[model samples]
Target: MAIMAGPGDPVLAETAAERIRELMDGGFVVDADGQHAPVHADDLAVISPHVEQASAIAARLADVPGVLIGTANHMHGLEREAVVVIHPLVGYREAPACATGLGRLCVALSRHRAYATVIVDADADLVLAHAQREAPRDARLATQRHVLAALLALG
Candidate 1:
């Protein structure tokens, strides 16, 4: 599920941390050999595009045992029962090249084995649209925009 926050929202890390706690407390379930099983805190991961945000999330979740917290890059090739991704461009008016890269978002969203939650800015579509309009010929940005659009549409 996608959680939309206001632009320049400074609490995504905190929100992610809280979500992990909720999932843990609420007995997050996962498919285990076609059977349902409760997920442990260690089975969850929180990923962000920025290290600063990652660090903040880690700090908040430090007491929660077994929850992995790191940047999207760190999550590559890893899988968890649940994952919460902090949108890279959540607070940006313009999409930065690094954040708009497809690999990062793909990794963050795909790392989850069962459940995935994305925390994005409420106006992410608008920001991406403006970025795409500004660089219509940029194939990479267009692809990223399309991918994000598809993701958002799922909700």
Candidate 2:
């Protein structure tokens, strides 16, 4: 599922942290290695494309014991029962190549076993639209822009 944190919203990482806290309230169960069980702190992960963003989310989640938080690259081979991904374009007016890469987005979204929540800025599509004005020259970015657009549309 996706949630939009608009330009006027709280810091993106804070918004994600709030959602994570709420998810931990109770009664949530997830499949772990094919067995169903109540979700634990250790079963949750918070992922972002940037290290600083991950670190900021980690600071806010310090009170929530055992949750793994890290950049998408840092989490490449890991999986969790649930994941909250802070969309890299959340605070940007234009898309950054580093964040718009298809691989990074895929890694961030695919690391979940049962549930996934992506927190994106409401204006992300606009940002990508602005970036698209010059995207055709770069085929890879053009492709990524299409994928990002589809993800936003899914929300």
Candidate 3:
């Protein structure tokens, strides 16, 4: 699976790592190395646009047992069954270009065949709007409310 931490939100990545570790402990197998085996440190990939953020997340997840840290470039040609994208919303008035770029990145990242793509961001509404606009017809939208409700139920 792939997890994309925000440009400056290392905590989000750390939390995700914790959740992933918990899931792993509960028998969630990720990228079984083509043998349906258990996940190893090399199976999970953490991606971010900023090298520093990516590196930080990598370091935080270093002891997770089998997770790997990498830049967004690593996603090319690879298939991830699950992905978590942590995007920070840039106000359009502050920097339209940057906002557009991040939105494009989010859309591109969501195009993969991952069974689940969890995007955590304060501006999730904007991100989801952009993603839905560019998503394929088969894609379905899952709002944060729905996700939170599910998590609550599980709890």
How well does candidate 2 match the true structure in TM-score terms? Answer: 0.82
Compose the digit string of candidate 1's lDDT tens values, residues 1-155. Answer: 23344332447877898889888878657464677666788889998888878887888888887898898888879998889988777877678887788788888889988788888766667778888888889888788777778778976
The sequence of per-residue lDDT tens digits that candidate 2 reaches over residues 94-130 is 6777767878888998999888888876667777777
lDDT winner: 1
What lDDT score belongs to each candidate, Candidate 1 first? 0.79, 0.77, 0.47
Q: After superposition, how far is residue 100 of candidate 3 from its true place, in Å?
A: 3.3
Between the candidate structures 1 and 2, which one is better when assessed by TM-score?
1
Q: In candidate 1, residue 8 scores what lDDT?
A: 26
* Residue-wise C-alpha lDDT for candidate 3, range 1-155, written one tens digit per residue: 22243346556556656655654565345343654555444445554555565577767776675554544555555544444443333211122234335434554355334433343444545554555455534133334224433533543
Span of ten consecutive residues with least summed lDDT in model 2: 1-10
Q: What is the C-alpha RMSD of each candidate to the true structure, in Å?
A: 2.9, 3.6, 7.9
Error of 3 at 30 (Å): 9.0
Q: List candidate 2 segments past 4 Å from native.
A: 1-10, 30-36
Which pairs clash in the backbone of model 2? Answer: none
Name the 10 consecutive residues with the lowest summed lDDT in model 3: 88-97
